[model samples]
Target: MSDQPVNLVSVNTAPERAKKVIGTVIENVKDKYTIVHAGNSATIDGVKPLLLSIQPPPGILFCASMWTPEEQAEIQQIARETIPGIRTHAIPTGLQVQVGPDGVIKYLMERIDDIMKV
Candidate 1:
């Protein structure tokens, strides 16, 4: 697969845990993908333009917050308006793992791997 960038959007207040999880996740995927730890933003609008400007755009976006179906659809719609063919996947409540650092890292690795396969 082409080495399209992988964007990770994480927002955590805990320094130590965030460092460990984000650090580990970056280390694990850096060799194979161009990992952009897009950092937290006060609003998506603040980062949207930058993300949309990426050369090939990011192939996958791993969000730390779980959005409800309606919210997920809204985000997907907004993204599709800008980039056709983009898709969004939400992790259900039962399988969230946790909305913490670990969950974000886990989801990033798993989903990116799955997307890379396709």
Candidate 2:
């Protein structure tokens, strides 16, 4: 699959409807992401920074391209501002772990083998 990012138009002003259009483009996939381009190749929308997960189907063998690197820090900052010592950890993937203090990501541990080193 290609790593090129897809552009996400605003839902209201887009040439096509959000759910209706993007839906048809990705129906039966049963995944949050859309394959904007196809040909042994796929591209995803930029709104990926807003995505929460890319879960695997029961019969599927794998899932890839989960968290993005951009510091979509608003969500994190909100958590810190609203709460105290609220440690949040999300293992969005089996090997990858995210630990948040309040809301800011303290670190991302992608390999248990490297945990001690980290």
lDDT of 1 by residue, 1-118 (tens): 3466665443223334444665677788777766665554233453356447655654444333444566545554555576555444444433344555566667767875665453
Model 2 per-residue lDDT at 43? 21
lDDT string for model 2 (1-118, tens) is 2233232221112222223433343442324333331111022332222222222211111111132322223323332343333222222332222322211111221221222121
Native-referenced Cα lDDT, model 2: 0.25
Candidate 1 off by > 4 Å: 1-24, 38-41, 44-56, 91-99
Q: Best by lDDT, which number?
A: 1
* lDDT for position 97 in model 1: 44
